[model samples]
Target chain A: MKILIGISSKKYSEPTLDVGMRIASILKSSTTILDVGGKINEFSYKDVSIANELMESWDLDRPGVEVLEWAYNYLIREKYIEKNLNEIGFSKNLLVDKGNGRSEVFLKGVAVKNLSLILRNGDIIEELRDEVQSFEYDLTIIGGSGKRSMAHDLIQYIDSSIFVVNNFNLKQKYRILLAVDDSPGTSKVVKFGVRVAQAFNIEVDLITISKDGDFSEKFRIASSRAEKMMRRSGVTAKVKFSEGELVNTLVDIAGDNHIIIMGTSSQSALTKFFLGSKPLDVMESCNCPMLIVK
Target chain B: MFGFSERSLTTILFWVTRKKWLILSFLLSISFFYFPTPDGLSSEGHRTLIIVLVALSLIVSETIPLPAVAILILIMEVVLGVDTPDGVASSFMSDAVFFIMGSLMLAVSIVHQGLDKRLALLVINITGNKTWRIVMGFVTISALLSSFIGEHTVGAMMLPVALALIRNAGLDTGKATKLSSVLLFSIAYGCAIGSIGTPSGGGRNAIMIGYLAEFGMAEISYLDWIKMTYPMLILEIPIVSLILWKTFTPSQKTMDSSVRKLKVQVAKTGKLNANQLMAIGIFILVFLGWIFFSPIFGLGIVALSGVFLYLSFGLINWKEINRNTNWGVILLFGSAISLGIQMKETGAALWVAGQTLTYLEIIFQDVEIVRWFVSVVVTGLLTNLLSSAATVAVLGPIVLDMGGNPVITGFMTSIASAFAYLTVVASPTCMIIHSTGLITSADYFKAGWKLFIISVILLLIISLFYWPLLSL
Candidate 1:
């Protein structure tokens, strides 16, 4: 499996890098880290510096010269490629021929690749969106500063699956929550969540929230089915039901270092999901990482 | 509808879920037409009552969106011959409505400038590690800003600060600790209380002010309004802090780690830029104008000029303002004002007040204090269900027509309308806090009833002590 991590310029997020390492190592996945210089790079290339520092810290014996050299050259080549593309009446997008392709590094026995690309003063969010779609990534993880805009922008365009992590702790036992309901997307959400859980070797809890206990029977059936699906995938599973609004219930259930994989197209959440309402609502308050699957 | 085939079952459920409100609306409209007209009311007044009954029912039930319910009121008023198009149009565009529109625009512009980061720095700087102190910091900052900048904006800005504190607290919402409740409730309740402190605090204040002027009262100046209300706010802040502190007593004493993280979070926000400085300057200028010159220019014109300055100074663009400003809320306010004006014009308000006043007068025997209590209760109850502005628009007219002190009645109704402590849908501030996804509607009910009772007691105490001294 292939994992994609987009590291931003926000410092003091070493925990995000650690989170990426855990996910890659557990799934035995080939992970690619794209350290894109965001809006903060205009004043300073602090994003590149942080990426280099984290890379060197991750692998002490592997002299960091090769990674830094590759990263610097990649930045230079990216600029030249963009100018060449503009000269041919073909505007440059980060999706194709973007990033420093030569920059690749390994992190603690995990096959890690680092691409230091600068979006440089344009719509960095849009540029990053295209860059993420270039790979058929099974899981795309992005570092954030616990701001609503960072998670909201990435969640708006979900190609396959995405995780927006903020202030993640380095040493923590991650809890996995599968937020399922009777939506068209639930089956996909359940199967994908279970597969990821099995890969990460984590216990999965299936939670369904009903408003005023009106959907107890339906939630029971849904959680039961989800539990069976997870069990078949060789992942430990538990089924639970509570009654409240969906987003609020999830917020109440989420613990530290927990990853919430939610199905947005449920009966109560369908309309709000289309409006880009519930995901951001949950993200703004939920202290843990979120993997929203459509 | 039960025991049906798959497609038939789907069709049945669809109708029951989606179209039930439409059916209820139709039945309600037909039912109200048959409602008996009250005594001493014109035929036009009776028709207005029918429209009011339907509109209020739909709004309370939430069968349709609220603004749509308000628009339907406007449409039905014309269709039922309660008022003419020209009269309705003029009523819809009052100075009070313009003030609401302009204040909402100013709020959106202020929030868009990213000044909340600066506010967060100030709040966290004051609240270093002590859990109780942090709670007070949030309350103090929110109360101070919401008095001038409006409650909804302050609520929206202060919401992230509280949430960040919760995250740093490492307290899980699943456990639902008293500490968490203390933090979240402080922001919501602070915004609610502060909204009553100044003329610009909320549209309901301006609505009451405008109503008093139109109903043969001296135009209450901005400073005059502040003198009447700020003392009550001064009394309210500590009382509110005590209420929340006692209701949700924290299990632990200190939040050392969370406090440290808060300091770091404040430091991380960096410095304010030019746009933020200009936004703050514009806001201060507007606030000062409201304090000094609103009596001369009137509050609405002064507020409108501030929004014009926000535009001309390039602090915020028209598109951002247009996007952030809720036109639906403005439409709802306008239509509500139009309906309120109609209720006053056709003697609907007087007739309604007359019917209720008969019973109260029999009990109180012309006692002004007892009549004021009834007015406050009625306004408070209605405010819980409707927006404060809508509550003031509807009930302000009826109570002012009740023939007591118009200024006192206006003040009472406006303050009581902000007594929306019970429901998540009670006020804009409550709604914004609930959007944080931390507190549930049930949690609201749990804490709300207590605050409601406390707020009632506080209002009466102020009425007893301050109202007489100020001759309000």
Candidate 2:
């Protein structure tokens, strides 16, 4: 599996990097860490580039390079990347221009299958969407700074399963809240939940919510299947049924302690766009980390 | 739902959201097209106004590429019957466009020569150890140099010098600080005010000169431009430095060690080489050409001659120039100038000018103030939103058509466009400084509003009290 992690800076992205790296290590996924800088206006893009080139001649790092360097150091401190005998530290000269406003550096991974760092400029959604489309990654992980429109765009446009590392506490233990339903997408969500449970060696709370407190047989069956998958994966699990508004109930149950794992809404994309889906609402309302399996 | 896949629908939605401006402009254009042409306006002039609205929205929104906007203008001119294909093509490639193209290439060639190191030494050697002196020196040198070369070129060259000083002062270069803000804004604002000193200082000046000459209003020599605007440029240097210093005064009163370190660091680059000398020599020849022979050969051809010499001397290569030059800006300005001319030909400019006077005259009680309001205040604000050149290109013809001395009105519009102090998108120099991550958008206003107000007053004083002495 290929995973993409979006990071902004050294201050706000530490927890995101820690959680993403831990999960990627467990899954042995090929991972890429990306930093998106501010958008340069089109009228001044070329001139800004000329200035940036001049800055390089003066032995200075360009705007986004410093963030990438910080991430590179984080990777080394965690031993996600093996230390090279010849190369001692992160070097700006190693960043290879991949064109289309992307520059990347490759490193040998210790736990992950393959590791790379990428730098891109422009709107975060546009750059992330383009990166995902061009790379075809299976999962994208990002820090949740809680911008509603950014969450909407990420859920609607990015094809990969999204892991928003929101309010993740490294010191506090976290449980998995696997949101199960009768939709066709629930099966994939169940499988992903098991992997996540195994990755963290944490227990799972299998939740099945209904509007009228009437849990149909299919809902029961889906919950049972998810529990069975968790058991098979050696993950401790509990089954719970609730009746309320779907997003509010799930968010209340997850609270700030559980990492919510759920299926994307089975509704049409157009419907989901105008009237947001459950995953998007939960992602927006929840304070804990979330993984919406697409 | 309509036999489209879910992924396809999402993709379409994304495109719709991203390009909502483009769609809005198109709808607005269609609605405006059906409205009856107003009295005193020709049908073609009405259509040209629609095109203007569409182009302005698109350019400001930047929903589409600039080159696409340029092409759209050309297409609409013919399709809307505003101008014939031949007429549109002829208007699109003016000497102003050539000057723009040549100056961009010249900026690339000069920057590629790695003369910024030399520039750094020169600035520090003059400014000495005092931080305030360095700030003033930066403003003075940036203003004077950018007046001859373009603002973008000087902004690019001077940025690293300021950054090096900031870094050597034991501050985080990656983070924003008062020292960095003051120094960076010195370069940006200095370059901005400096661009009005001469026609070659910015593409907008060339565009204004082109309009004046093309409209048969007046023929301004390169030196004539200096005689009129250079005093204002000189007066603005200290004003910019003082405003910036007051707004973002650093705790470091003296950058003694920083200046020493910078000087030592730049010294390691050694003396200028033969190639650097030749590059400087070619630029001198270009400057001489602009001063002495611009009237004979035109500013555009003279600038191109400099680019030719740079190429012939191998000071810079075609590949470097091609990589660095902003072709989209050249194209967009070409189209914008073409639209400006069509505004004149179709009587749209006259109609707009007359209507503006009729409406604003009621409040201002004088045509001169109304004209000044539009040319100075309106153009100044628009330059902060749209590019300075694009502002002048679209607004130049209307201002010239307004009832006043065309020279004064024309000069007012051109110079007012340099008041790009309010936003990062105001000018390339602002964006260049912003790219360092040392200054924020809000920081622009911390000092910008003061300079903006002061500059308007200064321009007013010059136009009313001083410019009448020239009596062009």
Candidate 3:
């Protein structure tokens, strides 16, 4: 397995990138560090000058030279550190952007390299529509800071996998709750849930809510699908289904569960995720932690 | 459909007719004179009044979208032989709307660039997490921004900040309802204070300056306005903060001691992006221009300059800037201003004022004492009920008719205008806050009454004692 960890040329990105590289090394996977340049366009140099002039005219506090120097050093460290990692018989590469140029860093060991697109906000999603469009990662290992909204966004985007290192000292076996719907995504969801169940020696309970009614037939189909996924993955699991309001039903079913895991299409954020008539209804009603997989 | 029985409809109609009896009577009298007789309302001069009122209601009720309403109003004007379509259209796109559009673009850019959040967070950090501290923080920031920017912009800016804090803290959304209500009203209060700090803070402030010039009192510069108002704001901050804290917060003192966590979160917030920084710069420049450059360049010019600069720089596009402006509020402002003009021009306001004074004399039997007391109470309460501009317009000429000095009239009117201190829906601040969907109108009414009482008393103190001392 391999991963591509992108880093910005800022001091803040240093600690996060270091942690990412360490996790990749532990997982025995090749890690590529992508160094994103500050120059977003050809006129970036002139843009900086004009930015300073405008700031001064407005009597704003100007960006100091020290910060600029730190940015440059951080970019340099990306290449040097990757070389050091490569020396340890680990597959490591540094991808740097020449000023105002575009580039890509591929996860080479993956079966499909074109699963996701890395573009800025306004980039046309349609341009990459044909790409099977999975998460950028098969699984992402993150440190204990679960508070960052951006990290939450990245996890949802990939819908790959997430491993949250919690505050508890123990390498605890996580209790998993899988909320399933009749979609292709459910197959991947069940497989992932079963792998987790087997690995942690925890039982898996699959609950499918019949939002459209007539749950008996749909439940049988979902149960068979879960069994088939488990059989293929060489794991045994239990499945059941019930019917009610979506959010209320899910929350009630997830009582005392360690986490509520579900997936959304890429580009969901905190606000859009919580928007509804009773937007906070589920969060207020739910007792256990929610791990929303986008 | 939710079944509304005929019996229920009849009951509702009975109640509505009973409550609206006075308005019904007035409407009946007008219709009886104008419609059936054709001799009742003189069509000679009242044509302008009739044309403007009908046009205004259509625009404000927004039964149709603004452009459609504007077109309809223009068409109706031509059909009614009131004016040409071109003249009506030109009137619809008034200078006030243009000024409002320019200001709205500036506000929207500030929001888009996320500068408003940064400024808000800076205030929150400085004030700490104590309930009183939070109130003080909101008041200080609102007052400062309202003074420099417009009150409406300050209200617009702080609302999102209050919501973001509530959501990020994982507190109950109910907490947001009251706190946001208070914050919005604070913004309105700040606007009131800030307007007095500068001539361009509001239309009323400019009118007050013009009145001062007419009286040859002083050339009240920006600094002079600030000098006069800042002391009052400083004195009132503690009182307002206390009232708000008492009203919204729980009685128990369970302080949020995770100060370090808040600090870390603040640190983690990414630095201002280039666009955001540019917007802040433009806002500050425009604000400074309003304060110091008023003698050379007018406020509208400086404001439009900032708007144009941001547009030319690609900080915001034409669509973004255009969409940022609220034409509804602008139209409302024009309508209010036009009503004020008509009230004075028609001799109706003065006649009504004379009748009110006569009634007051019959009740109190002392014209001077009754007049002064009536002036204080009526202006104060009306300020809370209506938009500050509308409140001032109604009260300004009334006080003038009572033979009070111009400065005293200006002082009392300005004080009343600031009385939106109590509720979230009373001012621009309240309107912005209410729009967040955090604070409902009901929430403001329930919890806001206590704060309203405090504000009313404070206004009384200022109007009776503070103004007399200052003006003397």
Docking class for model 2 is: high
Clashing pairs in 2: none
Clash pairs, model 1 backbone: none
Put down candidate 2 lDDT per residue, A120-194, tens digits, no spaces.
999999999999998899999999978889899999999999999999998879999988989999999988888
The number of clashing residue pairs in model 3 is 4
Candidate 2 stretches with Cα past 4 Å from truth are A85-87
Give DockQ for candidates 1 onward, in order: 0.03, 0.88, 0.01
Residue lDDT tens for model 1, A1-294:
667666543344345555655566556666665654322111112112222222222221111232223433332343322343334431111223233322333222312333223222224454455555565666777765565656655655444467767656656677788887776678888876875585467788888877887765666677788888887788888787788887888887986657788854333322333465776788777888777775
Q: TM-scores for all candidates?
A: 0.62, 0.99, 0.50
Best-to-worst DockQ order: 2, 1, 3
Q: Across residues A1-294, which tens digit of lDDT does each residue of candidate 3 receive?
A: 444444332434454444344445444455444333221111012222223233333222222222223322432354423343334422112222222222233322231222111211111111111111322445543333344443433332333354433232224444667767765566666765665555445666666777766676655786688877776766655676777786788777767544455544322233333442221344345555443332
Which residue window of length 10 is worst by lDDT in model 1 chain B? B6-15
Which regions of candidate 1 deviate over 4 angstroms?
A1-294, B1-22, B172-175, B361-370
Candidate 3 residue B90 Cα shift, in angstroms, is 9.3
lDDT of 3 at A251: 76
